[model samples]
Target: MAKTWFITGASKGFGREWAEAALERGDSVVGTARNPDDVQALVDQYPDTFLAIRLDVTDRAADVAAVQQAAEHFGRLDVVVNNAGFGHFGMVEELTEDEVRAQLETNFFGALWVTQAALPIMREQGSGHVVQVSSIGGISAFPTVGAYHASKWALEGLSQSLSQEVAGFGIHVTLVEPGGFSTDWSGPSSKHSEELDAYADVREAASKRPSASDPGKPEATRSAILKVVDAEQPPLRVFFGKAPLGIAERDYESRLATWREWQPVAEEAHGA
Candidate 1:
């Protein structure tokens, strides 16, 4: 069956890769980007199967309208990929209030609004998939990217709850926790705050850590996503890279250990 996919931020990075893969598989796609022109090449290539639309996911009303329009145009939507977001790099103290708010608005609230719009359509049809693009930072924190981590963590929580609520309606939700890829996420797509000397040591240590930009490949991510889309029973949450997979495993283990270590203290608070 050829599914109709509605993907946000489809002009570049993982979003673009997903769109291309779908079209190659003879699926119909409604690709949304802030600048429609950015995705024109795809429209040109897959003239009958692809529709490029201009959209800013932050605008709730506009996003709803676009989703509705895409569904109407395709006659039905089988998948909704909320892949529209950017990375914000800076220590929490260094980032301004507006910067933090902007990060949350696009990364967390943007996905929320898109999900709200897509749910009714999916519920009516009784079948659809919603893919939320999060990051390893959603589960584990790192220096210099605190704001980005916070936004992804919020997204992770929202997608987890959404999966439970929509399962009865035959609507599936997948939270993709990708570590790093050879994309513009850390380069042209990311926003950086003014550096402060007070955090020099921490920043230096962070810089010494392995770079996310050169490790993962976008083609591999595209293939993994396609598999998830085609699965009869996809996982609620999946890690996309070796780094993310290992990080998540270690993080949960550490969390469990800490909880057990303090279990007595926690139980004593109840006065039992």
Candidate 2:
């Protein structure tokens, strides 16, 4: 059976690639972007199978409306991809309150609203997939991108809980964490905080990281996404690029070591 997909940020990057992949494979897709014009080409290319919706994911009401409209148009939504978020580059101390709020509103709350909107429908249908576009930053912290990391980390925790909650309802939740995709996420689509002269050295070090210099091609992830959505038992978390696995391994090892080293201290807190 052909699946129906509602993908946010369908105008570019992984969203665009995944949407076109599904459409090309005879699936139905409702693609949303802030500007409908950005995705109009897809609508034109696949008139019957593609829908372009104007959506600002941060708008809670509009997100609900878009999800509802997708279900109505397609008769059912088989997949919901919350891929509409941008990277915020700022040192923790350099970030302003508004910048932080804007980062959280779009990257964290945006996905939350869409997931909430899609759940009832998926629950009623007894089957669906919700794919959250998280990042490698979700699990690890780095300089100059603290706000982005915070947003993704929040999403990571939320999706983890959501997966366990929704499993019995036959709704699958997956967090797609990519390691530096060759998208505008760190380029044109990225937001930056006002720089502090004190952090110049930190900024330089951050800019020279592997993620800044090398990024996987965005189009290469289409097939992987298709496989994930089509799987009978999809993973709760999946990494889209080569870098994430190594990063995860190193991070987890360090974390385990630290935790183990502090096990006595942690146990002492029980006052036993």
Candidate 3:
């Protein structure tokens, strides 16, 4: 079957790659960006199968309208990819209130609104997939990008609950957690906080971290995404690169050890 995809941030990076992959494989896509002109090339390339439109995902009403337009145009929406997000570089203390809110507005609330918009349609049709483009940062903490991590972590939690809630409606939700990808995420699309002299050492050490090396190719993930959306039972969470599993394993191991160590304390708190 030729599935229909509604992808946010389809102008560049993973969203563009995924949109092209689906269109190449004979699927239809309504690709949205803040500037529809940015994705005009894709529309020109796949004239029949691609529709490029303007959408700033942070606007809840705009999210609803875009999803409705997509469903109406294609007659169905089989996949909704919330891939429109950017990295915000700031220490926890260094982050501004407005910065945090803006980050959540796009990375967290944007996906929330889009998912809310699509759920009704998917439930009525009894089939759909919602792919959240989270990062390995969602699972682990880093020095300079705390806000980005918080956004992804919140997204992870939301999608986890959403997966269970929508399963009965034949909707599959997948969190695509990628490692460092060779994309504009940390480049043109990224925002940085005002550098503080006190955090210079922390910033320096973070920049030298081993995990920052060997960025995955953005185009390489196209096939993986294709298989995921095409699956009979897609995973609730999946990693797009090798780094995430090791990161998760280490993070979980440390978390489990700490939880077990505090088990007695936790139990004592329940005294009747």
What is the TM-score of each predicted model, taking all chains together? 0.98, 0.99, 0.98
Mark the regions of model 2 whose C-alpha exceeds 4 Å error after superposition. none
**lDDT (C-alpha, whole model) for all candidates:** 0.92, 0.94, 0.94
lDDT of 3 by residue, 213-238 (tens): 88898999999999999999999889
* Residue 150, candidate 1: alpha-carbon lDDT: 94
Cα displacement (Å) at residue 244, model 3:
1.1
lDDT of 1 at 47: 93
Colliding residue pairs in candidate 2: none
Clash pairs (backbone) in predicted model 1: none
Each candidate: RMSD: 1.1, 0.7, 0.8
Error of 3 at 67 (Å): 0.5
Q: Could you give candidate 2's per-residue lDDT for residues 104-156 as a string of tens digits? A: 99999999999999999999999999999998889988888889999999999
Which runs of model 3 end up more than 4 angstroms from their true locations?
none
